[model samples]
Target: MKVGLIGFGKTGKAVATAILDNNELCLEWVLRKRTLLEHRSVPEFLGIQSDEPGLIYSSLTTSMEELLDKHPVDAIIDFSSDQGIYTYGEIAAKRGITIISAVSHYGEQEREFLKELAKQTVVFWSPNITLGVNYLLIASKFLKKIAPWVDIQIVEEHFREKAGVSGTAIKIAKVLDLEESDINSVRAGGIEGRHEVIFGFPYQTVRLIHESISREAFGNGVIFVAQNLAGKEKGLYNFESLLLPYFYN
Candidate 1:
């Protein structure tokens, strides 16, 4: 699959590197906000040997239309901001390109926009796209279903620099039918990311934990989504939705 990447920050770079390394996926180009490394191939920047173009382009210089027209891709994996979709969502949808977005947050308006785009092409979005995180969420839900009276506590830990509550924790709470206030956030020294769901029963406590060791986990999650998403019907899908099938009896 030919892939276009939006966003080239730390996580974005990791996702691009993962794509470049995958034999089934091709890193076509990357679009970012700045022009600092414009036109530099991703392989050159990462110092890994690969033949894919993986060129970097700045949104300041290149319009989304120009980029898509010149370097068409089968899918676009976005680690960009919530507003990044506005740039290429419609264009890519109209052309039937798949979109996999790992943006951390999106309001109701952006979500509605994704639903609209799904009418034209496949669209998948996840606030926390790591496989382990989504798996933890699904398993927690299953546990809750089996034991509805258990007390559930969610705690999320992240780097100290990240202010406010963790979005992934909020998502976990929602999936388990808890309010945002039910989540506990802990900010500490350079923690990549960790989410723990504690289910307290009368006799014992079951904890489900997922820790992101590196940003490369995001890349791996995107690859898993892209591979499974092939030939799916057009619709808006969350990471859990893509993973739910595995738990079927």
Candidate 2:
């Protein structure tokens, strides 16, 4: 399988490395705003080299049409700008390409676009793609089902490097029928990630918490999702949807 990576950031580089690690896949193209002068090859960007000789370096261009036309990948894994992703998704859907994105497109327009696109193609949309976070979503649903009438509150913390709230917390909040503001986001140094959804009543509380000791934990899971995103159904899918068998059953 040939993969196209749309971002050259930490997670994008991680996904490229993971794809190379999988003997069944190859890097077809990579997109970044500026090419790294020293590390032109995807392997070098990911800190690994491909043993396969004559492997092509992707064409670097600013235009999406040029990029898509130059390289035809089996699947396009987007980890780039939120706006860029949705625009590309529309194009990918029309072109009948497999698209998996790791950005949260949560506004009214995004939801409407994704809902319409799902009818014609399969796509996976999630704010975060970590397996543990997906598991947290699954657990939250069960806790809600068994204790539907319980009061719910979500709190989460991430590294200061991460400027936003925990995406997983937001997802859980949506599942529990809580307002988006109900999910609290905290930024702190030395904390890779932390999330807890608490269910409370008059006298007791049930909490589900998932933490990450290092950012690499999420890197590993994100790569796994990128590689496995081929040939899946066309719809707005989430990591929780992928983990349905493990926790839902």
lDDT of 1 by residue, 201-234 (tens): 9989999999889899999999999999999999
- Please give each candidate's TM-score: 0.98, 0.82
Among these predicted structures, which one has the highest TM-score? 1
- lDDT of every predicted structure (CA atoms): 0.93, 0.70
Q: Compose the digit string of candidate 2's lDDT tens values, residues 1-249.
A: 666777767667666666676676667777666645323666755567685221223335345566667666666777776665654676778777777777654666776777787777877777877777777788788878987888888998877887666666777788788888888888877777788888887788887888876545545675666555666777777786677755546
The pairs that clash in candidate 2 are 121-234, 122-234, 122-235
Span of ten consecutive residues with least summed lDDT in model 2? 52-61
RMSD to truth, every model: 0.9, 3.3
Q: Give the winner by lDDT.
A: 1
Question: Which residue ranges in model 1 land beyond 4 Å of their true spot?
Answer: none
> Model 1, 26: alpha-carbon shift in Å?
0.1
Cα deviation at 59, candidate 2, in Å, is 9.4
Write down the TM-score for model 2.
Answer: 0.82
Which residue ranges in model 2 land beyond 4 Å of their true spot? 35-39, 52-62, 201-205, 223-229, 246-249
